[model samples]
Target: MASLDDLPLRADLVGRTPYGAPQLDVPVRLNVNENAFPIADVVADDVVAAVREAIAGVHRYPDREFTELREAFAGYLGHGLDASSIWAANGSNEVLQHVLQAFGGPGRTLLSFSPTYSMYPLLAQGVGSAYVAAPRAADHTLDAATVTAAIEEHDPDVVFLCAPNNPTGTAMGLDVVEAACDAARGMVLVDEAYAEFAHDRSQTALSLLGRHERLLVSRTMSKAFAYAGVRVGYLAADPAVIDALRLVRLPYHLSALTQAAALAALRHAPTMLARVDELRAQRDRIVAELGRMGFSPFPSDANFVLFGGVADPHAAFEGMLADGVLVRDVGIPGTLRVTAGTPEETDAFLASVARLAPSPRP
Candidate 1:
């Protein structure tokens, strides 16, 4: 037998590590930007009933094409999209991976903004594509000129824009997004995972789909519908793009149980919208309180805030953890991201921050 140490591994995966969000057992958890609320009891009961109905046919394979769920999702969006233009996966994360796989590979490049979603880089690597980034301005906004210049220079095959981006919570303007889509020689993926919580209605790149054959808008149930554990996400694009994803995805990739649960949640979207509004209000309150306490919290349109400009971010993070509050210490040097939780959780977190406040030192 050959020695295990002598075996070769995929060269691209060498020295690459798995990606993850922090998991810590602490009170007042606010690390992940999960919907701070859970499914309402009425909605839960409906989902349970639907799942039970689905289980009655457990012996049969689920719809390999997920036609029913896709139609239901399209109806919920009411964005004038049809089933032919929609596709689903376990989560929006998977949807992103599928898009990268379909469009990216050797001799290709994936372009995005820096200090954005960390997963973009990992996804690019997974698809054997070179990843590149253009830094956001100090105000956390994209500079279209710089991005256009980079596109001209590198001529990447895919571009990813996370509206109301993760960690930083900054959203790109429509003009910036449109320009990026126009400049890209290949596909442009706009991730709207947090769009439901933004101040304005989601500016879906779907509107540009007619003119731009390479535009895809990705959305999720995890953040808005509080269905993270259920793991249902979908993408809206041109029928051709959706067909390409269907070609590569595993048949029956979406389980019957997930389909049923997602349908139930979509049926109760109004209730979910109410919860999102409440969380948005809570996030605003928390940001205001943090400001009052002398912390420079960035303006946010998502359910979390990225506050920094502090002298010792790690110390502040540790202090919060010591006080039994858990927030994300995004290693951006002197920055921390905190998800908006319930009123009680918010109070506890703010109290912890107050305790850490003192003579601010550089």
Candidate 2:
């Protein structure tokens, strides 16, 4: 029973808390923005076979570079990327960790706009880098001018742009991304963890990669690929960037089973992604329903919607939980976020919230 204070810990982490979201056991779980559908049986069988092959050699360490997985990832991305230009790890969080470890340090700073993925600042701090936040537009938009001006002011060594951003589920325009890259004197990291769920795939920062060596686009199989349980996330960037990441990545960081499973998932990428349209339909339904109910649901390009006008977000969240539907109260006052789950799950959530009859914020 030793307290953290009793041990020698990093001074910066002394007062910080771990990133946590409710993992409640509920009949209708929508707190996290996960793909509601399970992997198809055929694909699941392929995964089983691939993993079985991996197990036969699990006694030894996996390929340190995860060559095959990287190749499969590049093929899936399909922007003429090769294995040398790709890198991956346990999850998108780890991909960010690698970026921070490679480019961030005590004297460097990591900057981003506010109301974005909550983990960016923490990731910077974890790597002993200074963190700075600039407020987004009043309407929760990130325009080129705003991002460029902030880049000039902060002069950070790294910048993080979360497209199809978490919490609010807004996407960054290509203009903003290009401007941010041009303005930054250092690395520009575009986190597209929810890219596959975007309304327009062409808006992704990946299209900017060939033009900017400093640009990096991070993605994950967790959300749209129904591979959250497999924990595979990746990035595409210049080969030099990938080389820098190799320096800090632990030897054999990815397990053989993980590599095998991810490769198998990539093989059946189309099938694994077949549920996206259904999920998008449900997402649109949620937004429209919320609007009709007198709430302000943000227009989302991701699988979840961040709706406002709740009298008390936490109260509404609790009410929903009481009825067995779990959603997130992302600490945005008078706002809450819910994933676009199955039709039945969505119906249950809508019914539960309708029962509460929560009023809009004035």
- Residues 1-362, candidate 1, lDDT per residue (tens digit)? 88544569687776666887768888778998999898899999999999999999878989988888889888877668788888899999899999988999777899988889999999888888999987888767786786787788889899988888888888677777778876888888888888888888656565666677788989999998998898988998889999889767987888888888888888898987788988988899988887877777888888999987667888888889999898988787767889998898898998888876644434
User: Which stretches in model 2 have alpha-carbon errors above 4 Å?
Assistant: 358-362
Q: What lDDT score belongs to each candidate, Candidate 1 first?
A: 0.85, 0.91
Predicted candidate 2, C-alpha RMSD:
1.6
Which regions of candidate 1 fall more than 4 Å away from where they truly are? 1-7, 358-362
**Cα lDDT for residue 5, model 2?**
88
Give the candidate number with the greatest TM-score. Answer: 2
* Model 2, span 107-177: residue lDDT tens: 99999998999999889988899999899976688899999999999999999999988878998899998
Count clashing residue pairs per candidate: 0, 0
* Every model's TM-score: 0.94, 0.98
